[model samples]
Target: MTEPAADSRTELSSLLHDLHLISSEKPLPPPPLPPITELLARLKEKLIGASSDSETSSLIGHVERLFQTADPDWLFSLTSVNEEGRQEELQAAYRSLVCALIGCADLPLCGDECSSLTPAAYQSVPIRAVPVCSALRALLGALGNWEETGLLWSVAPPVCVFAVTHFQDQVWTNPPSRAAARSLQEALLRAGGWRDSTHLLVGDGRQREEGEEGGKSRGILGGVLDVLQPQLTKDSWQRCEAVKLVFAWTLLQLARPSLSPHLPRLLPPPLLFNDHYRPENCMLGARCLHHIILNTPAADLRQFNRAEVVYEALFKHLYSTETTVIQLVLSCLLDLLLVLEKPPSSLDPSSGRRKPCRHDDLLRLVLIHMEAENKVALRRVYASVLPLLVDRMGVAVCRHLRRVERVVLGYLEVKDPPEETNRLKVLEVLQRMTRAAWPRMQRRRLHMLLRRLLQLMDDVSSDSQLDDLIRDKLMSQTTLCIKLLHDCSPGNAQTLLLQVDSSCCSPEVLGCLETVTMSTER
Candidate 1:
């Protein structure tokens, strides 16, 4: 490299001084930058020999200003480098700038700081939040142009990994800082940085073993998990929410098979959240667990009794009174249950001696809860999950016929307003149960269920609050449930309908029953 004249050095120092004094209230517009190329070259030269923190901070401020005020294309241009050494120079410059920017942003850039769980490790010093946030915004602005220039490819991995691990509560919770961090993340992924980033964050087996030897060698994702796992405990998860949210956002972007190998590390945090006492955290945990269960291969989940652990965590949430929490837990458990045991195929032989497994236990619990459930939202959730559970249980639903019949009858007797969501779902459950346990659906069960369907039709017709659409929906679903019951028992519903006097029943109820019997015969 040629020695720079004193004027070049003076100009660079003047630029840095000016940038240091710029007001933070508004963005500085791009200045005339024909000298920026020479200034950047001079800046790089100074950065190589820069030793003091003060010198580095000053240089980082100048870089942040250039990022914000300069055209990205002109700012990142490498036209001056010879072709033979272009790649090396480009990489060195990119690294120096990124490291400086990350440092100025007060984020963890090196392995040791990244891996540390202590709060002090994340906070380097008492730096101004605005300046740090501004540095991050500048970095994000530069990164946002990566797709157009493609010069950022080499440094994308570290920058992305740094953002994911360090952009937590402080950066993300602030409105402006959050926008910058989010934009940086989108740019990274959009520029095809996720591949390299994933490799760096989620290393292969050898890299993982190396990571285990010294925490310093761990990939950013693993290192983050180390810090995150301990904080995900019952009493501590609230404090860790910011990091957990970022972690999940990253984890969800990764698909199956790729995510499978890391399940053991990835599984615990969500389980802890799911097991938390707070509804919001518990819902978040269930959603995370649900994502993991869906993406992971069933064999991996079953390995080391992982599925059972997840099941136990989620099963307890079934008892939660928060309807939203219970809704998420039910969704998570349904998928998790499949990992523990496969649902029976239609061709599989029925065995009366088969042991009652998790499915049976879950169904029994849901039915027990359903029978006593009065809150409309809880009733809606339980009713919605029941059909899927019944379908999964297949012929084994015969085992819970008494409770199932009671639940069906009880739900039918009540009115779920507006759309009658609970009643509609309960009718679907009846249809699935009828199909699954047809042999058990004999005359007595058929009669009890049939009577409820007729009365539901009557009640729905009488309720002036229900609009034409909702009333029609209830009548149609109840009619279907009756038809399924008739098919299972064959002729019992017809006999019961015949015995009903027209004087006691409304024309609408009697008309709906006539439609079912007619449909069954045809």
Candidate 2:
């Protein structure tokens, strides 16, 4: 190869020199929240007024770095997806980025950039809006223009979902974040998030409804829906179960009159349902249904495209042979139980009565898991899941005490290694199960259940291969059960209390009792 002359300044040669300069900059500081507003204000100044393309471009790089700094999660995720450590960091950073982007868009910089940049840049018009308010939508409508950049267009739901979720965790108190979220939804909806299998269009890719005026969309939305509808079939973000679920979630947030028509195609279990018995399909469908159950308003459920089909899909997945799928299903079911919002009177004939809810169906579904053969079931999920059920639904779930007793008794049979861990998990669930009375159960049955609980406490075996930590956990769980019952039940708690003395209580249990008594006295 011949050496190039230095004076020519070939585009490729100049790019190489620029890369070296960028590589020499100081490492970005750890992204704390305090500096962001100021950082953005400076970024806004450079973006709006700078005539230098190079300066504008450098500031754009700062924007990306800001996202990386604000959310190490984006870096960790981009670097090592399977690593669990950065999930919290990613969530925090993501929330900050969402808020910051919205903040920047509201600045004069955004309007200036909008004008200076070619219309080609804002081609995917609506999804790229400032606040997605009626004003912005109308701005696009009046200008007859939109974004050329589909940059975040396709994956907007998952991004919107994560932002809204973190905002919810923050208690939805940030008005800018909330406005930004609504703006994003309008943008995405304009991008066509609510289509399903039945939405048809002419091959030239225009809506068949000819007379509706510019309703003859180049059908950009129809294409976006097509991409999202069987999203996973194509792989990457489109195929991700989380992305699929959040898409449904974003739609639920918008249940507007124009938007509700799009729900059937984008949601509805049957449209997305394939050979759901496959673990990947089952997990994807279960996850999507989970968010659907969560995001759909209680008032809109019945009207939201065969929601019964969705619930039935959930019911089937609860019995999934795959424990991972079942665990995921359990989480969705638990959410449904918690958020089982009833329809308002005008929306239902029940007129504020406790209309038939999927929660009742969920309770029956949980009992089926309990009723499954103990040796066949995954005790790990069962143990953790049942307690959450009883805790959330309270006495209504306690009605199934016989099922609980049967499950506990079935687990207590074997001291073998195969059964040891299962025993520990069941003991934890059982302790939580006994925190309140089963008003419907016979006192004899309660006695039997309580007796089993005591027997579990007393059956310590040093000969077992169980390590000290495992044994301690078992003992601690057993002690807490007694404490919970002691606190929550009346006569039953009193009856159980008589069974424990210095002899029955392990040192940990004794210590726990002392703490309780001391606190009570104070």
Candidate 3:
């Protein structure tokens, strides 16, 4: 407790505080996108202007040294220590190194330089001219090339995957060098993502005989799978985000058909399949799969059971708080359904063409999303979920129908359709569900859902989008309801028409009414 000792302790504490020794889960605003052009220029200058060949070799050696020396965890820790502004400075430096190694701005390798150089000399030799076009292709193609086991470049997939999935807007804006980027990306994939289960690697022999497909994978991808399995399987929520982000990027890259054959590890269920039920997780899963399915070729979707898994997970998350995770899940699912109608490559073989899992969960999730307090969130959820729901219906479907009834019944019934574009989605889903499952649906349940839709039509004001959607829904439902009514009791046609009249009173509702009337008469 001497004064000198106390002063020393205080100074040390201050230094520690300044260094950000403490960890924080509170999300920091994401680092700004790397300044691709500036970083590329610096890298080009560094490579092209070395005083001697020895110095140039030293620079390349420095690049390699970074991989060996830099501790990713240590760098992550520093992020918390620095102020937001200072953190940006650190990130800028980090990005410069990444761009330089990845070859963001290509150097010209012409004459004897590209052709005459030996392997070691070639690696050290600097390209003087810019190769932006080649660099861009390399950057995009990098994902496919990422490998883990080969040389130093193989590890680039995980890093690139991390960058592209999380900071895609920035990474794509101004990549350094296409050829180098591709080489790095492929190296990363080969190094990390390809390896998964012994089954995936060794199962190839058996899988070939069974004709079950998409099972073999290798390289950095394999390493990534090995690394992620423990983190995902455990309840490591924080670690899971890292795994998921990388997974998303990998999915984005492997979406192409040509690349599809190489990605057997991802096709099977990921290790964290159960965790995706959380809203954020679901969102990540949905968005990643959405990108892949849309971008990749259409194959037997039965193999990649992403849709079913997403449906199951989002079903659980639909009721979560209004966070980016929930929104992402909803938006991703919507996009997935809209853009890619089939399952992903990882589907269970037994499920057949129809998704093995029932879609009741998705229906329920959409219902919950519809109830959100935020209009924007709610609308986004509706835009995506509604269409899918319209495509499928069940006993639970009626429950959502009833909920909609309570909300829509209070508004001024509009004649123009209900234009809450999201609701139109609801209507579409309802229509699809009814059309497909009508024969199997219970008589009482079908009647109740139709009544609810009618009530919703009565609640919203006319001519608005909400009203417009309701009207269209009414027209569609009215026809189906009439058909159901006639199926139940042919003698009660007039009575059903009267009920329809009572429910739909406005001019637009009347047009739907007329349709119902015609149907009844027929």
Candidate 4:
């Protein structure tokens, strides 16, 4: 290829310099060129061999002018090079374009550019072939890398986690390499946290840890946790936004890896075991924690080997002499179990489903631990865990009730009928479990449990004179009971109908109950 003339090269250099200056300082206005149709015509002429070399230079200069000015209107001109055979040069140009774009804050190019690039355009850009495109692709790949890297190397554990929350599918499908993942993790770590007044991915990496002024190498998890705890309280939404990145990081980490055994060292111990009566805290923490246990097929849980550690760690909280800790552990445990039960494929025999594969053992251990607590404690745990357990094990959890004994049931039986709310809750759980177990159930226990739940439903409806909240609760329970009864097969319903009468509840409640009972009897 013949070298370009010095004059042309000098002009190109000067134009690039000027563009950079404009991009750096005051915004450069759009290229002082012809209208879009004219610009397209010029570009078309160049592509179809109609325009001369000078005309091609002019077209490039016009694009440079747009880059200098940071004009969104100039964005349309980018389509000029969006033709076939020019991709190699265009992709190279786009990198410099993006880098320059990142420097121009006034145009807000990142957000706008992200929107303008369609999925087709994203596919067209061979990110692997070009530097600028590669960088952008690297950023995209980092989202997936963050979590798996955490599991594999114990690096960028925080950012790796949060990235999973926002881009789990991306991470699961195509994970980046360990090195690329680490770099991306650091970029996110530096970008996601706060510094005085900014929420950024890259900035002055100086930040306070839990409001204290010091730079400790506490790892990504600690740094993020430190930055987040401050923002969680009242009247600090900006801080909250910054902290959200940390939560996002946590969720992302969860998507790929089990919680590191060392994560507790990063966060306050109390957060792991929140106060149970304070449903707000328990709910928030439990829900935040639920993502960790969610069905993520790509996640590698065997890397951390935390089940035994978690079981040992949480056992104290579960059997704690203190009521609050016990409550929090129960709430957290229920969430953990729910995640375990879903997407049956995760439990496939050959899928590297971790060491503690016998989930039944875990449940048995938990039951044994909670036995020493009072019925109130047992009731609290049962209520939170019941929904999930019923959904998964169905009536299986309640089977062989006599062979497996817990001390809490002793107090459970002694409670007066007036305090039957706990019993009602247990029955609701059993009823749902039985329904889920459906055809899998043995006829005898199913019949007995259905009869017991039917009587409990009657007890609830008859107590209409109770407090308004309790009365509303009982009525709702009655509705659920009727729905379950109607769903049961005629033979099963008929078997129970002979033993439990619907007349135990008020006439109004019994009226609807009679229709269900008679329909099932038929």
Error of 2 at 96 (Å): 40
Off by over 4 Å in 3: 1-168, 171-248, 255-286, 289-316, 327-358, 361-376, 379-418, 429-493, 499-511
Query: What residue pairs clash in candidate 1, if any at all?
Result: none
* 1-522 per-residue lDDT for model 1 (tens digits): 232344443443457555443233433332234434345455656655567767766766776666665554445554555478764666566656555555444434223311324555445432423344455456555765453333454455446644564445553234445455556656555444344445545544235342233222233555445545664555555553355675676577656667886787788778766766667778878888888989889889898998888888888878779999999888888888777876743333555454667888999999999998888888899999998998898888888989998998888778787788888888888988888788888777788888787778878888888989988888888888877877776667678878878888788888888887787778
Q: Please, what are the lDDT tens digits per residue for candidate 4 over residues 400-467? A: 24322232233234333454555546546545654654454455644654555455455555665556
What's the count of clashing pairs in each model shown?
0, 15, 90, 13
Better of 1 and 2 by lDDT: 1
Q: What is the C-alpha lDDT of each candidate?
A: 0.67, 0.47, 0.43, 0.40
lDDT rank order: 1, 2, 3, 4
Winner by TM-score: 1
What's each prediction's TM-score?
A: 0.70, 0.46, 0.42, 0.40
Stronger candidate by TM-score (1 vs 2): 1
Give the total clashing residue pairs for model 1.
Answer: 0
Assess candidate 4 and give its TM-score to the true structure. Answer: 0.40
The candidate, 3 or 4, that scores higher on lDDT is 3
Per-residue C-alpha lDDT of model 3 across residues 1-522, encoded as one tens digit per residue: 112234333432332232233233312332222222333345446755667655655555543432333232332234343565654454445444444543433322324311322244333212411232233233333323222212223233334543333232322222333344344434433433434322222323222334332324222345445544454433442432234555555455443443455445554333244344444444555565555545544443334664545455544555666566666655555554533343321244575433423344455555555554445545554555555554443333443555543333222122322244544454555455555444444555555555655565455425344444445555565456545544544454445456665453776556655666676577
Better of 1 and 4 by TM-score: 1
Q: Write one digit per residue (lDDT tens) for candidate 2, span 1-522.
A: 122233322322233233332233323431122222333344445556656645544544555433322332222222432356443444344334443433322311123211233434433322323232332223222222212222222233343443333223122224554465555445444443324211212112334454443322323334444544563343333323233444444443332333434556656542354234457656766666665655566456566335555556666666556778888878876665444444211134547343445554665566666657454456666666765665654444444567767877767554536446667767766665565443454566656655665666556533356676766777676666655554544467556655577775566555655654454446
TM-score computed on alpha carbons, candidate 2:
0.46
